[model samples]
Target chain A: MTVSTLPAYPARSARLKRISAEYPHALGLLLLAPMLSWIAVFFIFPTAWMIWQSFSERGLQPYATILTSAIYLKVLLTTLKICVITTVGCLILGYPVAYVLTTARPSTRAVLLILVVLPYWLDFIVRSYSWMILLGRHGLINQLVTGLGISSTSLPLLYNLFSVSIGMIQILLPLTILTLFSTMVRIDRRLVDAATIHGASPWRAFRTVFLPLSLPGVYAACLLLFVSALGFYVTPALLGGPEQTMISQTIMVIASDLLDWPLASAAGVLLLVVTTSLLVLYSRFFRLDRMLGGMAR
Target chain B: MRAPRASLAVNGLAGAVLVFLLFPVLVVVLISFSSVDFLSFPPPSLSLRWYRTIFSNFEWINAFLLTLQVGALTALLSTLLGVPAAFALSRHVKRGQNVVNALVLAALVTPPIIKAISIYLYYVPFGLLNTVPGLAFAHTVSGIPFVVINVVAGLRGYDRDLERAASIHGASPLRAVLGITLPLIAPSIIVGAVFAFMQSAQELLIAMFVLGTLEKPLAVKLWEGVRVAIDPSLAAATTSVTVLAILGLVTVMLAGRRARPTRVAVQG
Candidate 1:
């Protein structure tokens, strides 16, 4: 959708373009320098520095402590748990939306997709903040609770595992739905119809045929969402209780609140390693370019 | 091509989920216009006090202006870098492009919290943390990828023959690109820049880590409000940003007609 509709650059003039004829790579290299150097300086160099600082300060001790200590391990495990839960929650909420999308009128699907995009484009911080407003002590949820006489006082909705999950789920549900919808739309409905013709119930046809066909999309969506959920800071920071401390927040504490750079860097590096491993796994099994390209559409 | 409508029960459940996803946005807008100080569902009465309050207050005004400047600067810088790289990947280079793509998309893969801390480490000793340029620079690392992905997506389908024709007609390669190719991809460029701008506008985690007293993006200010107290003024700021987002999204969807509206679609 982005590139194919436009015309291509099919030919170069026979006359040597003096500037590029001298060195083809020169122009290309020059074009790439700014972005490459920007990444090198701001991203690569700093990440290198952090890893270096993490090791140099205590000579592998920060990594060791994180590995050995139950405290750090608990946070790491909890972070993993949160990411998993968020992914599962997204899948649960998303399947119906995706199914609805495929079944809807085209105009209706367009509107549904746009509404999903609205929140998806919204800032993560703003979304989290809105959740705070909607779920806080004096928030809408609490007001409704009291107004409905369900509870005399505000339910503890704002700061807990529940709020954190709510915020993360809200942020991720659209993503899962879109991915599933895109994949679901491409499924050959005739296969399901064939199953129904072969004495399968509608539910049986869907479960056996459509569900199996859509597993790839589900896998891709879960992988993407889980990786993102692992690093979620805004939702957890704003909506979570003390028990909900994810690895990202723990790193922030080490870096900022506790002012322990080495531990922070070590933690940061651990996160990078895990995420990069997932990405590498993605590239290994699936063509990442296509995954990303399809994702773009 | 269509089957009978799915069960009514399925539609009912789906509608409920859609409402859940959209509720926060709707709630925020509603609260932003509330007359009462207390945060309540549906509001006690309608008023523009929160909206007016944001304009009159110095901090809110300052944060809003700062956010706008940072977002614009990030957009400009990212476009300057990302468009060419997109062209290079699309037209010129091929062998090491995967490595390039990986590096470009690294920011998306890595969590924002980690990016913030790492950038904070980079900026701290140089005294660049919290400064406008530094913040904008931090944003560009993430923003440039969007520019690359977007512009490259636009580039994939671009007709090279147009440039070829221009070059054959006595225009230099540079002029061919400048006049013909660039204009053709102008919508993609604009869409990329809009994405970049929106990235900086809504970014707060990095802002929180690095921003000094001098510049507070609206997101950061709102975060402070969330941390310190629940205030209607925060809702006002949120509503304004939401309006900007709507405009930006409309531009993006129009520009790259079929591209995913948000990077989070992939990121999530």
Candidate 2:
């Protein structure tokens, strides 16, 4: 609907000529110098160097071990497992919320929608700390359970897989809701009505009509959440024990604590490959642009 | 149009989800007032002892200041770079623009940890590690993509005929841009800046890589506090950060409300 409607103001010859005479293409280049230079020096160079480091032994046996090592392979599998679980969890939790946001009255839903996304404004560290407080042995869950006379144990809440997953789910739910809401909002309610009018059950109507149409958004959101979950650092580091260490944690250990840049870069490149491949698969199934724009709604 | 029951169900579920999402943050604020040193929720006795402890901590103070500095620098650098790149994307139909867009989008799509590790490797050479400037630059990379995406969306929706009309009336391209385009997209620019602020401020993984012990950002401090200290003082710091975030969100929401009837959907 939007793409075909791009307004093309017919260029008047005189203005075009005059603008060409004084366009200062050089000036545009000059204006762009600082930004371009910064990106080149800070972003591009670093990425290139990381790739280079991945292939060479700077401080370790760095011959780009594609099939020689099992550690990177293990980290890759671990990242994938975590990401997939987080994505599925987000979908199950977020879908209902997105449905609610789309179906509710605009005025009432506005506050809820704002609340849904408000956490994005909060610092990640603060959120992690809140989880730390809530899931710690002396935190809310333990306190509540003990107060209720359910058990005397502290519940083994913090520094575990459960804590890490919960913290991640908390961070990721808003994104899933937002994306799902976008696509759901655009779904024609009349289609669902039509399906029901044809004697389809409410579930059948939704399953056949609404779900298929919203798949683009759902798939996109999952892609986003999964890819993001792959790179999680603070949540896992703060909440998870050493038994549940993620690739990001492992990379940090190798790079900073262990001082092994080659290993770190290799790990990074592995993560990048896995995430990018997933993203490509997602884009193949859905239009990323539509998902992005739709979700912003 | 009148699916009242379904709408109600949605509303009810949404309310529950919102509570679930927000409950932890609220709990932290509640726990900060506990009289005991250990974090205890639904406090047996309330006091401002943790607040006092947080205020007295020099590490917290230094980390907070450094975070502010980094956030400010991130916002500034992102705006400077992003606005023009956005302008180019919106105004011109250049070759390989899609590819350029994809690359910029990649920054957002790639896992933050991967970007951090990649940038860390990049930082090792030329001694860019453990510096305020290097950390700021890294944050800027993450933050700029948001700015560009938002500003581009804003500009894409704008009426280019207005620019044509202005230029035809003897206004130079530079004048047309400054006098018209920039002012028109001011709301998006503000949104972008706010996003940049929040993103850089909240960032933990990359900041962990680039900054040194003396230059640790607040997120790093919070991480250390939670992992090692795990006390009410950390809760106090959490409360402080939450309040600041709420303030920023409120300001942005109000500004967005005043600027226009509906926000120009600025996606990243």
Candidate 3:
């Protein structure tokens, strides 16, 4: 790595410096200013306003209500429980798929990769609705279950936490696989071979040489999955019963339906705080740039 | 060689998961052909009634046309703004670029609801609430980052010495970039544009915040169809959207594959 601490603008050539120095990094700043301003105005400003609104009187009441009431608290707890289960489910299911993808030939790898990403092409609403049809009382699952003599009539498949988790796991599993697969590809194959030559079992070779190196992707995937799960609106709103309410759906109801911007803003602000904190924690333990950039292990 | 049975079991299990993954789409496709009014699986009889209904309905057509307009506009604007920004970020190792990079990541990471709410609040003062331009603007902001990320990945993998050599032969900086750099990075730029188009097509939360009752995107249309009507015709609309999205993706993949690598090649 080049570690030269040359200032961004170096006076290496006096004549060229004389011509450009007056601009004082002006070109780069000029290019960046518009996007920076756009984010500041549209992104940072709204978030700051949301936080401010959260402290106001109306927000405090809902904030008090959410924190004090058992119903809201129960929902919040259930959301977290589901997020953890989904994360673990993705890890279990995704690891082997990721491994197989990485070990495959390049052409095969490319096709498999595309297959994994293809489902995500559909709109989130469409995907959730597709699940709604599949998992409904008289839907495919119940029909198949009855055909196999597993149940008498259609089962109560919709309007439950099970449907919510199944939908999320489907949407999330591909991402986890891709992330972990990229990291695994960067690992040194010789290390595994070296373990094998030293008489380590196949499982031991992976455990000792592979898994530790792959932790960054696992952590990154979990972080992305958790934050994404927290922001979920459409899936739970469609598949979930009244009890499986997530914070995003709650925010929408409060802001749009209930005509309470402050309360909605408060919930949005809380969601942001919780998700951002999880990201910060992940970044602390893992080099997120490496995972996101899909670079070396 | 531990156990053939274990290997069979593992393959069998994976096959089951794959089936589960595909089961929903399969069900929807089947439901779309159902003859019954209420959604019944293993349709008593099959017909194209719902598909015919889709064309006859003004609401579906209007929402679809509006979505097409928004998607096209968002894709165009995102490419215009994002391509140059990605070029600048990738080519430079300037001071405080990391902070700028972090800002983009923050945009990517922030929840859609948060983004929608922010745009809503910001637009209220400018009377931009419930407007197409406002919704398009929100889509553009989010969409640009995808282009930037993809294009920058392309740039990072590029060899920079080729441009320096062209400049040494006395070519102008703009000519060197246009002739040398653009040719090499075309694939990534095309990929970025494709991603931006897909993002614009699927977005709903922004439309929820910015669109008025008069104009709604296809995703918003889908949402309402699920909540309000829950009709059999909704399946036909859903099927069409899926087909449209896949076709758009295939078109991009083909265009990217066909993009000439040397059309913009350097001349000395």
Using TM-score as the measure, which candidate wins? Answer: 3
The TM-score measured for candidate 1 stands at 0.85
Cα lDDT tens digits, model 1, A125-225, are 76787887778788777878899999998888878888899899998887688767767887998898889888887777888999999898788787878
Off by over 4 Å in 3: A1-28, A56-62, A282-297, B1-16, B29-49, B94-98, B264-268
| Superposed Cα deviation of residue A149, candidate 2 (Å) | 5.0
The C-alpha interface RMSD of every prediction is 4.6, 5.0, 5.1
Which lDDT tens digits does candidate 2 get at residues B139-193?
8877777788778767767887766666556555566677766767776777777
Q: What digit string (tens of lDDT, one per residue) describes model 3 on residues B1-268?
A: 2245654655565556656666666667777888888777666788899988987889889887887788777777777777677766765436666566656656766778888886787678889887776777778777777767766777778787776666666554556678887767766776566667677777777788888566777888888888877767877777777778668766866775566443534273
By descending DockQ, how would the candidates be arranged? Answer: 2, 1, 3
Model 1's lDDT to the true fold? 0.78
Please state the CAPRI-style docking class of candidate 3: acceptable
Which window of ten consecutive residues has the lowest lDDT sum in model 3 chain B? B259-268
Q: What is the lDDT of residue B49 in candidate 1?
A: 92
Report the poorest 10 consecutive residues by lDDT, candidate 1 chain B: B259-268
* Ranked candidates, highest lDDT first: 1, 2, 3
**Interface DockQ of each model:** 0.38, 0.40, 0.35
